[model samples]
Target: MRVVIAGGHGQIALRLERLLAARGDQAVGIIRKVEQAADLRDSSAEPVVLDLETAEPAAVAEVLEGADAAVFAAGAGPGSGSARKDTVDRGAAALFAEAAQRAGVRRHVQVSGMGLDRADDPGMDEVFSAYLKAKAAAEDDLRARDLDWTILRPGRLTDEPGTGQVHLADSVDYGTISRDDVAAVLVALLDEPRTVHHTLELVEGHTPIDEALKRI
Candidate 1:
């Protein structure tokens, strides 16, 4: 399978690329900076320099051509203001989903946050409200598109080494999950089409990651 990943420079994105390559699947990373291409060479991924924030849908779809699946993993990290959060997180994701449809790619996946209930949470919203809102919007947009989509909403991300065990369910806990574990789940979902059209929340758990994904 050929997978095209948006925001390929992210730590989690790179991990996913490595996992895909290890499985003999092709991974193309869409990066914003030309220099970022060099980083992907060591990870066995081809980097396509493209900015999701400003690129047109047609241009984005061109990069997605011949891809078996497209994963929306781009986001504006810390130091980005609220405006950029909407533009990159929500707008870019939405555009990517639409472009994937235009390119006739049926398989799509999005990396979202766990606390995206769309309810009014006073304390947490104030701290990461923009991020939550953007994730919610992106999920909703993907759900409305014409594709076999799976949205994986992960808990607070930790940089700790992957435990290879996780909780996958409809209702989520706000526990921390490793980026490596999330990448493992993403690759698992690609092979299991039954996970399509389902939005699952993921976090570290007692069961093994492969077993948890099989149950999904």
Candidate 2:
């Protein structure tokens, strides 16, 4: 399979690229900086320099053309304020989905976050609230699209090694998940067409990754 990923330089994306490559699948990563190309090459992923925040949908579609699947894994970093949360999280995500449609790519996987239900809670930090709202808006937009889309909302992410175990379901209590485990699950989701149109929550658990996906 040939998969194109937005935010190719992100932690999860990089790990995913390596996994795909190791499995003999082609991986293309969209990055804004030319400097990141080497890293993608090291993972055996083709790197395309494009800034989703400023690029038109048609331009992005050009990059996505002939791709088997697309993954939206972009995000504004922790240091960024609320404005970027809207631009990158919500706006960029919407743009990527539109591009996928234009390119005739039917399968899409969106990397979202848990706890979006609390986006409107007054107790949350202002920027965090905005971030959640952006992610939630992005999820709504993807659900309304004419595509085979699966949304994975993973709980607090960590850099710990993957245990190859997880809790995957339509809904689950909030918990933490390793980035490695998240990438592994994404690979399984890409190969499982039965998961289309489902929104799943993921976190660390006893069930093995493949078994967890089978239960989905």
Candidate 3:
């Protein structure tokens, strides 16, 4: 399968690229900086420079052409403010989905957060809350699209070695999943169309990642 990932330079995105490449699948990384192409090359994935914040839907669709699937994995990052969170996490993600619709790509996946449920509480003015809200909006946009979509909402991400074990639930459940394991789950979902039109909450668990994915 050919996969295109937005915010290709992100850690989890890179890990996903490597996994796809190792499996002899085509992985395309959509980056903002042309210079970052070198970073993606080392992972054996083609890199297409694209600034989601500025790129029009047609321009984004051009990069998505001929791709089998697209993953919305971009974020404004820690140094960014609430406005950027909305712009990149929410607006950019919506733009990507629109572009995918225009390009006729039917399969899409979005990486979201776990705490977006109560993100709008008056007392929850924290940056993390804002981030969750942005993710929630992104998920909503993807869900509204006329395409097969899956939203993976993982809890606190850790850099720890992947255990290849995860808890996959149809509803919000767990609160911690490794980036590597998340990548593994995404790849598994790509192989199973049954997982389409589903939203899953993931966290590191005792079950094998592949086995847990089967339960979904």
Candidate 4:
């Protein structure tokens, strides 16, 4: 399969690229910086320099042309202000989904966060609240699209090595999950057409990745 990923340089995206490449699949990573090209190449993924925040849908569609699937894994980083949360998380995500439609790529996987259910809580930190709202908006947009889309909302992410085990379901309690485990689950989701249109929650658990997916 050929997959184009937004935020190609992100921790999860890089890991996913390596997994895809290792399996002899084509992985295309869309990044804004030319400097990140080498990193993608090291993972055996083709790098395309394109800023989703500024690129028109048609231009992004061009890059996604002939791709088998698209993954939206972009985010504004912890240091970025709330404005960027809207631009990158909400705006960019919407743009990528539209581009996928234009390019005729039916399968899409989105990296979302858990606890979006409380995004509007009044006591939440301003920036964190905005981030949650942005993610919620992005999810809403994808859910309304006609494409075969699966949204994965993982809990707090960690850099610890993946255990290849997880809890996957329509709704899972809030918890922590390793980035490595998240990437592994994404690969399984890509190959599971039965998961289309499902919004799954993920966190560390005893069930193996493949088995967890099967239960879904």
Candidate 5:
């Protein structure tokens, strides 16, 4: 399978690329900078340099051509303000879905966060609030599309080693999940046809990854 990941240079995206490559699957990463291409190459993911924020849907679709699946993993990062939140978080995700449809790729997986649908109070930091709102909008756009989609909302992400175990549910209390584990889950979701059209929440748990996805 050929998988295309937006924000290809992201921590989780890179991990996912490595996992796909190890399994003899092709991983394509969409990056904005040329320097990031090397990192993707090292991970065995083909890098396509294109800025989703500025690129039109047709341009993005060109990169997505002949791909099996597309993953919207891009973000504006923590340091940016609320304006960027709208552009990269919400807008970019919507654009990716549009390009996917135009490219005729039916499968898409989104990396979203938990509590985005209900978190309306970003009083202390309007930026964080805006981030959640953008994510929620992105989710709405993907759901509206005519594509095979699975949204994975993971709790606080950590850099700890992956346990290959997770608690997958439609709703769950707050908890932390390793980035590696999240990547593993993404790969599993891509392979699990039953996961189509489902929105799942993930966190650390005793059950292994495959079993957790099966239960979901």
Candidate 6:
């Protein structure tokens, strides 16, 4: 199977690419900078240089042609202002969804924030609030589409090694989860079509990745 990933340079996205390549599946990463292509190549993933921030849906669809699935993992860093949150988080996610439809790709997986409910706090930081709103908007957009979409909302991400265990549910604790484990879950979700149309939250737990997805 072939999967197209947005934000191919991100830590979690790169991990996912390596996993797919290791499994003998093709991985295509969409990056804004041409230089990141080398890094993706090193990880055994093909790279497509497309700036999601400015690209048209038709252009994105062209790259997604013949792909089995698409993953939206792009983000504007914490240091970035709220406007960028709207552009990358909200705007780019929507762009990918539209492109997925145009490309006739029926399956999509969204990597989103855990406990975004807290983002609704009126006193929250403006940037964080904007991110949550963007995430919420992305979720709404995907849920409304005709695609077989699954949203995985993960807790505070860490670089620690994966335990291959996690808690996947509609709501979860605020514990941290490793980027490796998150990638494992993404791959598992892609391998399991039964997980379609479900929105699950993830964090560290004792259940194995496959088992957790199976239970879902």
Of models 4 and 6, which has the larger TM-score? 4
In model 5, which runs have C-alpha deviations exceeding 4 angstroms?
none
Tens-digit lDDT track of model 2 for 11-72: 99999999999999999999999999999999999999999999999999999999999999
lDDT of residue 153 for candidate 3 = 86
Model 6 root mean square deviation, Cα atoms: 0.9
The positional error of residue 117 in candidate 2, measured at the CA in angstroms, is 1.1
Off by over 4 Å in 4: none
Q: Residue 204, candidate 2: how far off, in angstroms?
A: 0.5
Misplaced by over 4 Å in model 1 are 123-127
Q: What does candidate 3 score in Cα RMSD to the true structure? A: 1.3
Per-candidate Cα lDDT values, in order, are: 0.89, 0.96, 0.89, 0.96, 0.94, 0.93
Clashing pairs for predicted structure model 2, backbone only: none
Candidate 6, residues 1-216, lDDT tens digits: the string is: 999999999999999999999999999999999989999999999999999999999999999999999999999876999999999999999999999999999999999997667786868988899899889898999999999999999999999999999999877778889999999999999989998999999999999988888788
What are the per-residue Cα lDDT tens digits for candidate 5 across 1-216?
Answer: 999999999999999999999999999999999999999999999999999999999999999999999998999997999999999999999999999999999999999999885657635468888899999999999999999999999999999999997899888888999999999999999999899999999999899999988887
Quote the positional error of residue 102 for candidate 5 in Å: 0.5
Clash totals for all models, in order? 0, 0, 0, 0, 0, 0
Candidate 2 residue 175 C-alpha distance from true site, Å: 0.8
Question: Model 4 over residues 1-216: C-alpha lDDT tens digits?
Answer: 999999999999999999999999999999999999999999999999999999999999999999999999999988999999999999999999999999999999999999986877878888999999999999999999999999999999999999998999999889999999999999999999989999999999999999888887
- lDDT for model 2 comes to 0.96
Per-candidate TM-scores read 0.95, 0.99, 0.96, 0.99, 0.98, 0.98
How many Å off is the CA of 69 in candidate 2? Answer: 0.5
